[model samples]
Target: MRREEVVAQWQREYDSFLQDCMNRDWAKIARADEPNRDWAIMFEVDRSFINNAKSLLFTIENRLYDVLQFLLDKGADPNSSLRRYNSDRRCYESTTPLIEAVKIGNLESVKILLDNGADINFCVERNLSDRDVYFNKTRIRVKEPSDDLYIKPREKRTDDEKMYIWKYSTGELANMSPIQIAYNYRHDNIVDYLLSRGATMKVNIRPSGIFPFPFTTLGEMLRRCKLYFIKEVGLCEERYYALRTQVREFESTKKLLKGYEVRNAVPYPFRIVSTAVLLLDNSLEFKFQYMALYSLFILEYWNEIINSKTHIAAYAKVDDIGYLICWLVKETEYSKSTRQSLGLK
Candidate 1:
């Protein structure tokens, strides 16, 4: 690729990351034109990236786990508002870090955020209403006019006052609960983990101007549609050991490749940023692409080396490999930080 092409690629990914449906203020604006969303946005708010290269690189490495842990350990409020004072817009917008983390599909980061008291019930309404709406043609409305689910005067409503639908004060979908974000993004392991940690199952999926049912949990959505957020996070007890086994297998396979007279063959490291970039475009069928990449890196590289040299050279682009290694250094530093967190070796 030309220098300009490389620059453009970086620009595209950066633009996507900033205005990503996850981070942007969806607080009640209709997302009619946004193809990924069938739901209308009720409002709009501007968002900007944390552009400090040092800081962003830190996050890309720890994937936000380190900063989250540091904050939580220091008793930083987990439910803190993400108030972004856009000097350009001359306004303020805020959402929680948990919502951000869930959108990015960072499972470990989300786990720490949840454990530290992030609000499970915080909701960003897909669309707001001046009047009550029914769900699935059912007469159940949000139970009150001038609906404001963010109301904090009461500790808890009775069971009769069921969680009908998400309501937002900020007027953006960025306020969506962590679990809903996870499920929408098809982060199955994250969705499951958040539910286990008490994230609410209720999410609003009703089409706008349609009769909205006040009560619908994600569990209900799962039943309503035969969709799957399926994932296997591997063994719990063997998290460390499993990674070791993987490295061992990687080394063993490397030696085997050498014995087969495969020269200059570098096994692809399964670093998140490096590998995840390949499948970023094909997010809906998330896991399948990931599995394909894993197989290609582990099993098919040598075959490509023997049979299709041109494709192998393209696959192992020097710039791409360097980018992966640059990102990998952050992970190594993150591991050191995590080790300190656990007071373990």
Candidate 2:
């Protein structure tokens, strides 16, 4: 009954429980379950914090739900951080149970965690900040006149304010909303679901360094349309002409359109860029090069427009295409006309 003896006894009990869990000896675990089974002992195990439920949720393995249910029944804490077992290279420094659910797109797992009181907005110190400041900074204001007559009197507020005005702020993951992540990954279904569940679209969430001219989102949409047309319908002159017409319409709307629209358009140009890159090694030198150069210029113009804004939200919704375009131009050779067309020396 010395202190050391008590400590030794607890250690033995903990090790036994760990072995039972690892071997999945459910009978032993149940038998060993005392009145207050001291489930914290399981947390002390080296890999206990790492949930098998996560792998199951992500569909990396099968039958995860059953395992998770068993663990929860045995007293697994859903709020527990798995950083101890997760490596630095893994997505999001340490994997939380909720994040695992999100990545897997498993509504069941997400529901279970929510029911069990999992912190949906929990911020584990991975590379990105938990409360990204990205959402809070996004500007989605309705323009209103101010009292000042001499100066341009437009009042602006954050998207958070607009959401509050609309009474759409019940979900727990408000800090870094899951919808934002869905948008980042281009998970259309998830994005739609999140929006249905009260996710508000902010005008300023466009990816930074994009521009208004040839709007990035519009370009992206066009690119996707072209790819679909080529793969599904085959590349016909009519289809190509149709896409060009849309691009022209986009270009004409340059000054009036927001960055979000541009980011949304990025899919169009992205497809064209992909095709042009593939064709670069073939016979159509000038045509491919021209398309590529035009794409980059459009991206550059978008970036300039975003950066010119005083607020960060102005460029938050823009995609990463601008940076990609800049990189492409730096790495490739360009024609004289291409350079001149893009206003590059």
Number of the top TM-score candidate: 2
lDDT of 2 by residue, 255-290 (tens): 213322445433123222333433334445333333
RMSD of each: 23.9, 14.8
The alpha-carbon deviation from the true structure for residue 177 of candidate 2, after best TM-score superposition, in angstroms, is 5.8
lDDT of 1 by residue, 1-345 (tens): 455655555456445543432343332112312233211122221111232222233342446555446435544566665445546533343556666677777777666766777677665433232133442233222422123332222236543333433332122222345565665576767766765666564433233222122223422322221111111122233443344355345445443233222334433333323233233445423323233223224333433343321122222222332222222322333366543442223
Q: What value of lDDT does candidate 1 attain over all alpha carbons?
A: 0.39
Model 2 — TM-score against the truth? 0.36
Per-candidate TM equals 0.33, 0.36
Report how far off residue 300 is in candidate 1 (Å). 44
* Segments of candidate 2 deviating more than 4 angstroms: 1-62, 73-75, 84-92, 128-345
